[model samples]
Target: MKKIILLLTATLLSTGVFAQVKTPQPSPTSKIEQVIGLTDVTVSYSRPSMRERTVFGSLVPFGKLWRTGANENTKITFSDDVKINGSDLKKGTYAIFTKPTKENWEVIFYSDVNNWGTPQKWDDAKVALKTTAKVGTLPMKVETFTIMFSDFKMDSAKLNFIWESTEAMLDIEVPSKKIAEESIQKTLAGPTANDYYQAAVFYKETGKIDMAKEYIDKAVTMRKEPAFWYHRQQSLIYAEMGNKEKAIEAAKKSLELAEKAGNADYVKMNKDSLKEWGS
Candidate 1:
């Protein structure tokens, strides 16, 4: 009787303890958002804290496809056409995946991002660009996902997606000034790029003669746009050249562009300069 009673007591204790216990859940993953100049990029992935005993060849095998990150597949998107490793990749979003090896890793870009694993056939990866990176000697490990642009410049950057002991990089370039000029010609000259006209007035209005001249050229290259900005630029040039009458003529045109652009400051400044020249 006592044995039966004891057994019943033990069973109740066990049930109570079991009922009170709760399993631990993984922490929420992090989201990375970044912009490389005109290119807006975002990377979303999950990560768990891992240890020497818990990761690498044991947890993640050698020479196998890693989702590049945990949970959802890693993804990257570009707002414009960019060069990845000197290879032109059109504007699109892609999944960043990789194949691990003993000494190096095979980086991959997949056209299909929603899929969970790397299917044997890679026809779906339309614009795949392959690159390799070797393991670091210090046994570096990354617990969370990361993405960044290294070697950033006014017009270019090196996009690096790094984790664990491996990394992959791709070069990216923005539209250059020449390209902007060509764009003007191709579209058969508009008041768009590389034009000096209204843009010069805008620059003068904004207190940036240098930038104004730069962009005005872009606009002039566009053609059929307001020539007043160009004439205004010419006026400024004449003023600098000590040609008072020519300067006055150019200022009048500049006034026209600024007025059209609703730029009050340029009109005031040019009016003052013309008065000084007359005096």
Candidate 2:
């Protein structure tokens, strides 16, 4: 009797160890992190494949609140405040729920981020943002559930949900103009060495030779260890100013630095410029 009990315990332990072996999941998890303008957007969800079965109205019923993905609810996070479907949405992570219909889809962003399947006790108080997106028919059937961004601009894009033959879209907008203007103001107020160098390059291209020379001189002085590229810019500025002596001097300095750095491209560029300038 003692031997039998020991054998039974060993068999149960072996079965538990074998069960720990991993296998392919029916629905796989996916994560996406994307940056739009100055904002960071992240999405986490599970993708379920269609095994030659109808999805929209059959596998997933119409006019019912869906968790938006298999297992845990789909999550979307925003680093900054944004607009969804022209409605204000604060910055944070939210559980995305959906209600599909033939004409339009109701997209809900719920404050509750932890839940399994549908919220058993649905709470309207937990709702953060709710909007509607028009449903469209796709040309071809999609075998797996997909969420993607499209029609991207500097400040805005469209989030698309696709499954089977239906597509739902939501417009997302960020404050790109405010961020850009603030960045420009901050840069112009207290410019860095690289900023001065970029301004010099811009001025040189725009036929402002005097400003180019001034900014380049400031860049050379401000930098702790100026690179070969900076000397190359100085050489170009001097050459454009019709100062052949200074151009030759700057080109020689650039060639020496490039050779020390083992940068074959810059070496060739300096050699070509020196030959052109008779340095």
Top TM-score prediction, candidate number: 2
Name the regions of candidate 2 deviating beyond 4 angstroms: 1-16, 191-279
Residue-wise lDDT of candidate 1 within 110-208, one digit each (tens)? Answer: 777776555445674364666664444336666644566678776687766565554556667765545657777967844444444556666667777
CA RMSD of each candidate after superposition: 14.0, 13.4
Q: What tens-digit string does per-residue lDDT give for candidate 2 at 1-279?
A: 999999999999999999999999888999989888788999999999889998988888899998887989899999999999999999999999999988989999999988998788999999999999878999999998988888889999999999999999999999988988999998787988898899999999999999999999899888899688998999999999999899888888889999999999989999999999886
Score every model by TM-score: 0.49, 0.64
Off-target runs (Cα >4 Å) in candidate 1 are 1-27, 52-54, 117-127, 133-141, 164-170, 173-279
Clashing pairs in model 2, backbone N/Cα/C closer than 3 A: none
Clashes of each: 18, 0
lDDT of each: 0.66, 0.92
